[model samples]
Target: MCTLLWQWFSEVELNSGELYLYHNSGTARRAINSNKIFGIGTPRYHFFNNLFWTESWWGNLCSDPPNWIGDYNVYVRRGESPLWDTQKNQAQAAGIDLHGRWAEGEISPYRDADEEDFRLMEKSPALDAGADAARLDGSPAGNTMACLFGIRLLRYGPGGSGRGPRRRDPGRLRARALRWPARE
Candidate 1:
């Protein structure tokens, strides 16, 4: 079972769409059903975690995004209680030890998304202020969005055949039970 889960993890891709780890939000040992999210393409790992941010996402927003990417982004978020000159002021902090929130321990994909609603995306201005905000084309952003996503790594179950790492349903509260010591 552990081997299946491991194999699944090793094969997850980040180009399909919204990926999800089969099982509840707490189930650890599970599979990635690429057909669950949008159900268009084969249920494959398409999303990755966002590994770019200054402040910790766990503490700040407590979210897990697919594909940990580097985001040099800029977005327009409606500011509230404009105490500062800009609404994006306190909302855009960066560079935090997400390890404490996400990579700190084992977590089921379901629980992560359920708690946060899977709405974590990076923001960037797509354009500079002095770069002709009218028709000014925006610059490319590095992955600066602050989030930690858990992508569907593999798909192995009744739905797929040799499609992903073969893993049994680790069911709820099983994430902690999975004890596969790193192979020597």
Candidate 2:
């Protein structure tokens, strides 16, 4: 039985859709799954610059889709499992996650996941791991917009003092910049 974190059913149509610059962590099952008819599933699903971390053996990253385009992402697994390596290798061989890397560490890239602080650590490999925003086909990934928004919110929003440094990093949030302020 394959449990999925994000699943697309056969009824939904996703053409030229892009999924990028997101961060998915924790003990979920598969990160992405799709319903297939015959052997082909959805098409034109592009994934880029995302991070996936899992602590369980059931944490398969993606299902095999014929035209899925994925790259520049990071995959991290905590415990030892042959299934994890095998599935990852199969995904690569099947033309998924071509430029993606398997981050090897027991420690999470985030500062304190247990505390719900999804900030990237100073030495995190995911710091500069994202692809250029302009290179993506669609409107830039939400992460870029969120970073800009987060900055504005911090500088000009309600309690903001309107005076602070702004920096940018890869992944879901402006984690490195927001969490660890830049030093003079």
- TM-score per candidate, in order? 0.19, 0.54
RMSD of 1: 19.1
Q: After superposition, how far is residue 42 of candidate 2 from its true place, in Å?
A: 2.5
lDDT of 1 by residue, 1-184 (tens): 4345445665555334334221111221111111122212332322111222222221111122222211222222122223222212222342211211222122222213457653322222121211111111132333222222334454556775535443323111111111111223
Cα-lDDT of candidate 2: 0.50
Model 2 scores worst on lDDT over the 10 consecutive residues at 174-183
RMSD of each: 19.1, 11.9
Clashing pairs in 2: none
Off by over 4 Å in 1: 1-70, 81-124, 128-153, 158-184
